[model samples]
Target: MQVSTILLRMPNWLGDCVMTSCAIQKLRVTYPDARFILVGSKACEIYKADSLTCIIDESKTYPKTQRWHFKKQLVGLGVIAKIKAYILYSLKFWQRNRIYATYLLAKSIGKADLSFSFNNSFFGALFLCFTGSKIRVGFAKNARSALLTHALKLQDSHSMHQVQKYEFLIQDFIEPGLFAHILPLKLPQSTQSLLIDDKQHKHIGINPGAAFGSAKCWQKEYFIAVIEAFLDQGHYVYLFGTDSNLSWQITQGLRHMSITQQKNFINLTNKTNLTQLVDSIAALHLFITNDSGPMHIAAASSTPMISIFGPTDTSETCPWNEKIAKHYFCSHRESISKQSLVVESNIAILCKHLSCAPCKKRTCPLVHHNCMKEITPQEVLLIADSMLVS
Candidate 1:
């Protein structure tokens, strides 16, 4: 039952990858001597510790081909010839890529005793099967139960946090009582120190972009108001996000602020990578963000955060550090009043008729994002002020 060489297929998104850190730590402790091979996206770089023997960057491993270019090149050919050319090119393209991927995967997972896939997709199961490990473990959903040597049933409740859901994959292998003691997610200390001259002022990070879509994003004006509130308190504000068009729009809004406001605010959107983002967040006194990937990253960093939730289910994706942090749900249950209220001992539900929320739609199907729009900046700023003071 001892695993000598283990191949772990990680989740794809940045937030989910962050959540896997705790589970990975548990596995490492459970199999102290096992050699670990990680197959994941660029976000998985955060898990590259001494215990990891190899990391297969899934993004780089399967490079995307330019099928459009081939189509354009064959534009001058006869209709039949073009059709024939397209078919031939498509087959050759897939065959070549398949061979390369298979070779790389085989090399990465050579002679593995066990393989675990944290992803629940059919393709993830197929990847584990192709690794040729003697024992393959994964969730039994997506009709991939037959592919796994040991398949755990998916948790039925949508309220279960992803961290707990991932732990279900390896529960049978570890000791009975060890699940409750899973390690907290911790980022590796940076070798290169972050230099910031103003140590006197408190630093706050604001993330306005959500990778899921605009439906999860709060208004840019609301973000600006929050940033201004922090600046007024003589605190430094740092904006975090990826290099997307939406991030650029948010950055541009910040750029047009007064010279004094610009001096206190720093726009780091599109600039920092995952490692750098972790280091930058680690330097913060507080973080205010949407229910996005960076929100989860800040949670893992153990920063004091206030996550604004709209459209997405807070019970499922609320920051794992909810006890230490606070979340404002832009939603309302049937019996709750229109105003924000403490429904539970620690949790607060904020909104007017959030019946439209937890819609899970990337964009509002009704073309009205009232769920997010209804959340006022004053309420959020008030919460941030209280957390910072406490």
Candidate 2:
């Protein structure tokens, strides 16, 4: 059947959405005339060039009732009341708007001739089913095989990165051997010129907050140490984070520096939106971050990066361009499992001795984040120096 309109259900997280860029680019190349509609988070707007119609915000379309319930239970237990209350209020707002958003999404989906879901969740499959597009395609996981007209089996190996996994799913629809040559992600050129003094000065971007959880975040003390080391070496530092409280804490730590040092450090936490964040990252000489969404965004921008990893599987979620970034693992399992996948020339893996790494917990199960603590800032700085020099 000739496909005139294609509706793609994009992955939820910003990092996952960035990883889907290559495959989405491939689909655009293969189906140049077909109209494309992307359904995912607002972050998916970054892929506006490849898409034709509009982006469906998943946060509105699929309300996070399970998370709301979990947090409400936490609030009842009197664990961090203030924070939980704020989160609960936000979730309630989303819940109120979800039905109307879902109605609009259903109406949009009904117009598509074919639908594809990059997401592996049962809810994603259900959304495709609701589209009633007859030609729904997606991975047959979460017991959603029945919902998809063409359900591909999930790959069993953990060796492949998420971007490659996305490509594997997209290959079924395209001609043989064409998926291998898809172009890498490139953001639109910035209209406003970047306001910086000297282009020759090395600008290092530091992202201290990880939205997934604190388990994925390295110690703030360690981040401060790295920032100090860079400033001492006459390098400019730009701290980036989405969390206002965390950003303020980091900013306060550097407030006592001399005027020279203060001038070299810039805190951009909670300041820029998604589009501006990309533009800012594109101007950086290097970006050092935890395993977060911006790490993938920086990687897609082709900015050199050093990503600190804990608990999460690096083999599954490492930056797509291995040749341009270094990944430091906190656990032995990640170091061992991800060693073979690392690009020897551009990528290096660092790990300290830890038995409980790859714990895969949102928060540390043992109440100690030794995995992230043991990795010293000096060690990271040495590697960063080498990467910059080379």
TM-score of each: 0.83, 0.81
- C-alpha lDDT values of all predictions: 0.71, 0.73
Tell me model 2's lDDT, rounded to 2 decimals.
0.73
Which ranges of candidate 1 are over 4 A from the true structure?
49-54, 57-63, 66-94, 97-104, 191-195, 255-257, 322-353
Model 2, residue 88: what's the lDDT? Answer: 72
For candidate 1, write residues 105-150 as lDDT tens digits: 6656665787888877776777777777778899888998898899
Q: Give the per-residue lDDT digits (tens) of candidate 2, residues 102-196.
A: 65567666856778888888767777787788788888789989988989876564656677778878787787777655355555536332326
Location of the lowest summed lDDT over 10 successive residues in candidate 1: 324-333
